[model samples]
Target chain A: MPTINVQMFEGRTLEQKRAFVKAITEAACTTLGSSPESVDVIITDVKKDNWATGGVLWTDKK
Target chain B: MPTINVQMFEGRTLEQKRAFVKAITEAACTTLGSSPESVDVIITDVKKDNWATGGVLWTDKK
Candidate 1:
């Protein structure tokens, strides 16, 4: 079983978010062939300042 | 809003998992004090082989 949780900045349109989720889930399903139900996908949208990678806040990264 | 995604190998009981979630959520709530609805916590249980770190499968690591 494989589950993917995506955390990103909160600005994308609903369609954009849906497409992203669909693509990711399909990739995981096809690559892993995990049960659909077993694959849990959650998207958490946060303020740009809430996330950091490589010691730099995402808001400041760009 | 702070959401924590926890991915781990499967085996823990419901109670154990609930306790873990509760502890994590409470800590996050206290530290971040985000709205309960905004604080989403998702747990993904995977087979040992499905997860890897540092190019090593979790099943083989332990």
Candidate 2:
């Protein structure tokens, strides 16, 4: 099974999640020849304060 | 930097996360020789409906 974990800012609707998982699964199947039934996508909604890039937290941006 | 992503069912406390990250970072440093500051751990809390095993979603189980 191919398990994919995606970390992104929170606030996406359920409709978006449904579309996202469907698209991601299809892409993986087409590109890697993986079966749809074996693909698992886990999406994480990270807080702005919890995420940092270039050693700077997103929440700290002014 | 080594980024490790973990996928598990939701409902863990913040204290658990603090301990988890600390242990995982240490483990990576000891085994892979990666610095703690360079290691990033992202945790994904999955719902039963979003996770499946043996072609059956966990939520669908009765």
**Per-prediction DockQ scores?**
0.05, 0.16
TM-score per candidate, chains pooled: 0.47, 0.57
Spell out the clash pairs found in candidate 1. none
Per-residue alpha-carbon lDDT of model 2 for A1-62, expressed as tens digits? 68876778887766666667778888888998998888887667779999998999999988
TM-score of chain A as modeled in candidate 1: 0.72
* Poorest lDDT segment (10 consecutive residues) of candidate 1 chain A: A24-33
User: What are the RMSDs of all candidates, in order?
Assistant: 15.1, 6.3
In terms of TM-score, the best-performing candidate is: 2
lDDT of 1 by residue, A1-62 (tens): 44556565677677665655555445444434445566665767878788776888878976
Alpha-carbon lDDT, every model: 0.60, 0.79
Best by DockQ: 2
TM for candidate 1 is 0.47
lDDT of 1 at A54: 83
